[model samples]
Target: MTDQPPPQDQPPTPPVPPGNPQPQYGYPQAPPPPAPPQPGYGYPTAPQHPYAQQPGYGYPAQPVTVVAGSGGDTRRGENRTIALIILAAVVAIGLIIGSGVWYAGSSHGGGGTAGPGGGKNGTATVTGGKEKVPANPAADVLFKVPQPKTEDPSVPTAGSWLSGRVYAKSGIAEIIGYDPADGTKKWTLKFPGPVCAATERVTADGRTGIVYQPSMPTKTSRPGCTQVAAIDVRAGTELWSKSIGTGEFATQFRNVTVSGNTVAVGGSDGGAAWDIGTGKVLWQPKPGDGCSDAGYGGGPKLVAVRKCGTYGNRTLSIQNVDPTSGKVISEYKMGAGIEYAGIVSTDPLVVGADAGHSASGGSGVSDYFSIDNRTGRLLARIPVSGDAYEGECDTISQVEECKGVVAGDGKLYLATKERNEKKAHGSTNEVVAFDLATGKQTGQRAAAGDSFALFPLRMDGGNLIAYKKPPYDKGGQIVSVDGASFRSTTLMELPAAGADRDLQTDFQPGYSEYRYTQGKFFMAEPNVGKPIGSFDKDRNLFVAFGTRD
Candidate 1:
């Protein structure tokens, strides 16, 4: 039976009715059972009644059209641009090898037409895990937008930027935007308290805006996080901010995410949805509602997982909600001793269920399950076949961290690490492709060298981009894997670092991570853990490896 809250008490057995009153005096009445202990820690003990769909607040009858903007290099000087282009071409010809498939009726058929910046005119097809690489990826580094000056530089909001070259980074007190091309100040938006997380994207109105949440000064104090705001991307002004009455602990909230014009914010207590353009609160979880962590899925679908029952046995509700109205559209239930569920993807609705494996011993694997977001039916359960070595479970934020697991070109790619007998330490990383619909392993390939593990970056031009795992020294190289044939080709070796120091492993602003967006790749190399002073030389830079414009 679906778990529900204990029924409410009936009005105190209306005083013994006249005739029965005499008999009641002789016979002792049973004392009423103690009311179920009030819900603990704000979470509801009972299941929430699925709400009916209603007209969405401050939304149109039809879906709004969202347009993505383009990004380009705005040069600081003509000489510098020309020099970089020439250097890019030289590097391409020397380091990059063709994938061996070219268009018809061209003299440079196998090689393809190389633009001035050394990017190919047409795509290349290669088998055996090969990639078509450009000559000089560093030539695309337009400029490095520096982090802003603040009183306390220790804490920085996870920085994000728009394709229009508007870069944003937050300090404890404020969030600031900058032009990436010339290091010019675009705008700054200050909050009453510290900013927790920030996300920005182009809106349906053809403008960019940022949704940011503020953290409480004292974490122990109740109600540390009560509000979130939308800031104009270019103007650096607040459009509107709304307060959620969830007196939840500040640490429980995830970063704000923007899907279309709607922004969703989730916390430990519950979640709230708001129209980004207007500050109208669409719908929020009422007190004692079991639902938490509301997030946007594909289309008008909003997805969240709710938990009930007690420690040992728990039931999870995967809810598909209306994004605009915050009404529960459909619910799919999964229980039978499932305790924790982490969301990996939302479009086809991929969720990773923790099988209660500790990081210490045993397989320590997570079971990946795919569900149809619309129908709320289980599609497939991809068994855990890989060991928890290289590409294994790290704390969840989805693709950003575990670049090893990716969904692209109608297929799912996963990188697994296995213990190698030959090696004294370290394991071998292998790439496995699976059919998304069938959950069948299509092909498996190992990284070229035994020394380094391959971390799948992002898909570019219908190809998978992967790189050697860190301690990324001079020998590290970037390889592109073909989507169709599963072929991989060495693109280029990484530029030499300043010096080899203790490698920082944490994923943070100054830490190293590979990111691909808008036909460009960024490798964050920070000067932390070095001899650099705390303020003066504590610089963080992103090396933009990009294709020719």
Candidate 2:
């Protein structure tokens, strides 16, 4: 495939702006030592011993004194009192040294507990030797890939998958698989055009779907996204490629996904399904009704978002359908005035929408509806204000593209907007959960300590995997919060200084792809384009960090 500029009629959407730089922290100056105990006439002459230095940073040498009394029984009481005072001083010095070590560890990338409060679950235990929490968690840069050069700044490059020991990343017009540990290129799958849409969900066997145009677009001619292909990421090869319709009436898919044995693609034109193994068309959108499938959410189950009615006045129906037959098993109709709805999950049947376009800050979500997929019953309508929570949904044709929110374990987890702390100079945030059945806050909050912001990545069994955007002078961290107790354990920490630290913090949440498996954390740009200026040659496409275990 060749690089192409977007058509004149369809302008490219600008990417999200980079995040503000965080303030760096420096070690505090040590305070002066306490004045030596004042001597009095009643007090015995100050006894002095050799001074011994503390074992940590910023601590002054401590003096150990021995009190000797030549006076007889009358001085016994005074001797006893002096001994007690000396003992107290020794204990205090030990505590100060211990505290110093802890502070130093936390400032660096040492393993430290994080959250709003402690939990009853205690420390998490490693299961199957995967995702083990390190005692002093720290990660080293595994590799980085520079952004591919492109004249057009709007070329889509949004796809990545980790299969077996290989990491496959979408480039300008190709998918390349690289060694997960090193930066060696394993294989490449070339496409005829840039990838327009890609699904994050991969089949159990490492197969995924993507939509692209058949040829490159030029100044005068631009092609529609009519090609759909299934790739076996594990094998680093394309399984099959196909398209539908012809000429101007051809269906241009906006998104693609895989569910069971079916590869589904949808758009404003309509929806269609095909067999994954054979690439044979299974079903197409039926006519007679004004409704059309806007998009689909695929994983475990396939749910379609069907839009009907005339423009400016539309209704949406959420359908749980059989993947192979395209049969609607259950349906829930959304209220009018909701022009678009994004699916947060297919199994739990959670939908997010901006009702009446009331959402602010362009989050594209004003509320969430939790439905029972089996019976098509609305369990609860949870109101989420854009001003308080940080969740995003694409207002375009991508229905399953949402960020900053994760739904699992019968709960919807959302990250709160970052805010300045009342007692500190840096900012902080928290991840709060809402009960899907009741549509109420669970009162459980996992905090991202001062100077850090937390965003939910995905769920691991019952736990929630979260990414902690680090403050300046520190490295980003991956944490796992216990589902039952809300306790967080650090799984991996990135570099704290040098070029690695700069690269690690460059990929901000909500704007980049973050994947953590085993003990490795991968961050890649979802879309890459030409830099705005001539001096922006240092742009990167992908960076990986892994624990030193």
What lDDT score goes with residue 430 in model 1? 52
Output the worst ten-in-a-row residue range by lDDT, candidate 1.
85-94
- Error (Å) of candidate 2 at residue 501 is 1.2
Clashing pairs in 1: 92-135, 128-487, 128-488, 129-487, 129-488, 129-489, 130-487, 130-488, 130-489
lDDT of 2 by residue, 1-549 (tens): 012112122112223221111111121222322323321111111111111111100111122222222211010111111111112011011110000000111332322354323321124563322455655567899999999987764567778788788898998779999999997998999987777778888888888898877776666766778888989888898889988767666668877888897788887666777778788776665433356677899988998877665444455667787787666677676665555677888878888876544554446666777888886777877766555667766544677877788888888888877777575346667787778898766767677776777888888877788888888877888887767667677777788898889897557787777888987788987766667676457878899887887
Question: lDDT of each model, Cα atoms only?
Answer: 0.41, 0.66
User: Which structure among the candidates has the greatest TM-score?
Assistant: 2
Per-residue lDDT of model 1, residues 1-549, tens digit only: 012122222222111111000001112333322222311111111111111111100100111111111112111111211001100000000111001111112121111122222234333333332234544332234445334443332333443444456655554456666665455677887776555444433454423333233443443432243467776666667788766543443323434556566666654344566777887776554444323433333322446654443333334556665566544545555534343454545565665444433222111223555666666666655554322322332222211122256556655566655334253244444566656566555644434344355666656555666765433343344566666655554454433354211111222211344554434444542211122254434444343444453
For all candidates, the clash counts are 9, 1
Pull out the clashing pairs in model 2. Answer: 1-192
